[model samples]
Target chain A: MEDVTTLTKIQLDALREVGNIGSGNAASALAQFLNRKIDMAVPTATILDFKDIPTILGGPSTLVMGIFLKVLGEISGRFLLLIPAQTSIKLLRTLIPGCEIDDPLNMGEMESSCMREVGNILAGAFLNALSALTQTPMLNSLPSMTYDMAGAMIDNVIAEMTAVSDKVLMIETSFIESEEDLKIHIFLLPEPKSLMLLLHKIGVN
Target chain B: MSVVIPVGMGELKVARSPETLVVYGIGSCIIVSLYDTKSKVGGIAHIMLPDSSGIAKERLNPNKFADTAIPALYDAIKGESGVFKANLHAKIIGGSEMFPPTEDYENNIGRDNTAAVKIALKKMGFPLIAEDTGGKRGRSIEFVLESGLIMLSILGEEPREL
Candidate 1:
């Protein structure tokens, strides 16, 4: 794998373009689901080297929504959605309208269903975009959900990816939908040799 | 008067009045509550890990680990209002398996935290009155001081008395 510092400019541009398309597709799908106009804006993509994940995420408090996609015969990573606790609750309420929670909140079937559907939609859209850009057939695994302290989440993701691939590249993006801003982080993990193959395909290295 | 004691990570709070002791955002952490009806006193400890013996030996705060926090909670309630008894009722919440993969590291923390609390309570001769735990979600718990009632709320579930 090339030094992460060297690929910043190129990777950032590629990721931003990819995010723009993916976010657009997701917004359309969500809008249809809600039967209302869902405005989504994709901000510039930020590159987070695996080592700097904690710093990029700020404090140890983070709500993560991760999506895993298999692209180019390799299982790459994508953080299709991420938000703070405060934002997550608000988004949950927005997605499931009129869901009233009492003092001691317990998640019921309706709320779980809503979150799962949202994860599926976001992961589907993002994977589709990634496949089209890479000119490779991509398949996505079932979406899994979890929440944790930011540091623990980042550490777990990195550790898990490293066990599978030699190097992992992450693409980070921010989105504003229905006046709610959220973070979307996508990870691309390729074995060293596979990464070289991908770069050759893209005419990069 | 209803006083609200918000317990953070590695912290414990005790109240004697008809107050509510709560802990929020309990992801992969344990929230243990000890209530004594005779004195109308309750104590809560929000612990992050199962045991303190392995990691960060220097940062040994009794309230930070289930092993130590459980004992500290008992002592605090006893010392504060003479409510410590082996038969004190206990209710626990917020040990959620909030990770996607079953074998993943993130998933183990909650399990470990829950196991530690259970062990500690058993060793101290305390019986668990009620519990709501082990799910892929977050929880907020409130211990009503007057009635020693434990109420648990998960993200999408209805609030129920434990």
Candidate 2:
């Protein structure tokens, strides 16, 4: 089994470009949804060990709101959108701006569904860009929303990959809405087979 | 002084009295905590898969699979902690169906993992004293060796001792 850490710089750069184009489209879609300007940091593509996953999200036990979806069809993988609890509330508020809710924490089912819808839109936008760029036909499973500890939520996603590889290829982009403290991370975790296919598409052996 | 040992995914840890074995963020994966009251020794394994037979090659991590992990945990406790098999009790946590169930049973990893752990426990002759498994939520668990208490905390719920 080849180690992901052994990926050449060119392969890593190719992955980073994929993240950039995908997140760029996602940012535009989010900006339209919120009717506000959005700023995105340069996307980062790196390989992480199983234990390093939680630390990147915050900590093993930190509570986070995540949206999970499985990518089917040509490029099989997983997509996740994660934000801190408070930031998630901010996202919920952005969706339902008219509602006079003081604390985002004190939200209800309506808010939760709204968050799921937002996740669907963002993930869809990102995948569309990726499909176009790589010319790979990809479909996504229904997105599921979860408010849980970062460690647990992320652990489930990467569990299957553990048997195949010790390291995971994680591409992430952080974006923020204008004049709000809300920050969200868009994560793409492609399966090993899918990753190799992507690398091959990008002309890396 | 009490020590808190964290059991990472596919990893196992063994600790003595005055210490706690903890694993956080148990989604579809399960954490098997074994403790011997007589010796005040405990070990925790964060298992991601049910069986090792499905894997392609010889993997180094025995703790990643339930069938391998159960015997490994028993050996670690007995050899290093000097605890006999008869004195060891088990507490299982996690194995949450984080996503909705799919038509393919093989894809339903949470349910599969729970079943595998149960089978392993039965085969090893170690009684399952308590369990907090098969839920839609994730859990963080702590096993305190001194009191043989397992503390479980859900996201929006209060922490409880089992």
Candidate 3:
């Protein structure tokens, strides 16, 4: 019945290192894909109570676009890349020039598929890095896109995690592209057991 | 004085007349709201999972699962206002499959949650009066205690009363 909030300083530092490695790989991948300079903040890994999750990502009612992928293999979990609606449109514009970014909900199937691919590429980059660092084999499912309230989307992640623990372990990193005025967040929610496996691998109890 | 009571995950609350009960960030999770029109008293449970069986809990968190939450809601409404179970009506909302399924991940938890909530309510003999469930969008719900009116709002969409 240990909550994620009780992680000792050493554990937090270890997790932050993992976050840095994973997001570092992801940022480079995105930068290459967009063909632009991308800057990322220092990654943070922390355990938070379930109820506080909604408020952390700009409150419960904030509208956002989420790209989700399920990670499978040695370490199973979920990965998410979330951007504001405006950021998503800008991303679309950058990815497919002349493609209409207006109407976040209404988009061609081809455009939607492009977004999905963007998710796959970004999620793959982070998972690959984590997999390499932990020496754990990991694979991801095809990416899926949804536009909704950020709180509601996070509820799905929390619901999946509840079977194992009431606490959620989150690795969050924010990145920005100066050319497009785009700001996006990358999140990793490793299963509680898988997280322990990671901590054990890193020599933390 | 009318107070806005916020119901977070795995939580439930009861409010009297003129007070409002609200639950936010309901995606795939179900919100079961019970109200008694005569007494102007109501309760809302934010249920995260469908079933509670096989889980070890040192303390019973009734609001965390549909199976336990509905009966708890029935008792709370009845105990606080002397309202009969028959007089109570249920409105369910926020079981949205927020994302499409991938090759390996089948995102059907929203349907599972709605079904479980239906079964739980049926077993408790509480009739369901309204529901807004099963979509790709997330929803927020507001229940007014004065008239038992439920307001459902999807982001970027106009709010509707049910």
| Cα lDDT of model 2 by residue, A10-64, tens digit | 8899999999999999999999988889999999999898778888999888877
Of the two candidates 1 and 2, the one with more favorable TM-score, higher being better, is: 2
Can you rank all candidates by DockQ, best first? 3, 2, 1
Poorest stretch of ten by lDDT in candidate 3 chain A: A1-10
User: What TM-score would each prediction reach against the true structure?
Assistant: 0.54, 0.94, 0.94
CA lDDT scores, all candidates in order? 0.62, 0.84, 0.85
lDDT of 3 by residue, A4-78 (tens): 666788988998998898889888999999888999999898888788888999998888888988889867888
Indicate the residue-level lDDT of A89 in model 2: 69
- CA shift of B27, model 3, Å: 0.8
Give the DockQ of candidate 1. Answer: 0.07
Q: Considering DockQ, which of the candidate structures 1 and 2 is the better prediction for this target?
A: 2
What is the C-alpha RMSD, rounded to one decimal, of candidate 1? 9.2
Q: Rank the candidates by lDDT, best first.
A: 3, 2, 1
Local distance difference test, candidate 1: 0.62
Best of the candidates, DockQ: 3
The candidate maximizing TM-score is 2
Scanning candidate 2 chain B in windows of ten residues, the lowest lDDT window is B99-108
Q: Candidate 1 regions off by >4 Å?
A: A1-80, A83-143, A146-173, A177-205, B102-107
**CA-only RMSD, every prediction:** 9.2, 1.9, 2.0
Candidate 1 local lDDT, A34-132, one digit each (tens):
565666555465434344554566643444443332332553443435555554565567677696643213557676566666767766776676567
Candidate 1 lDDT score at position A11: 56
TM-score value, chain A, candidate 3: 0.93
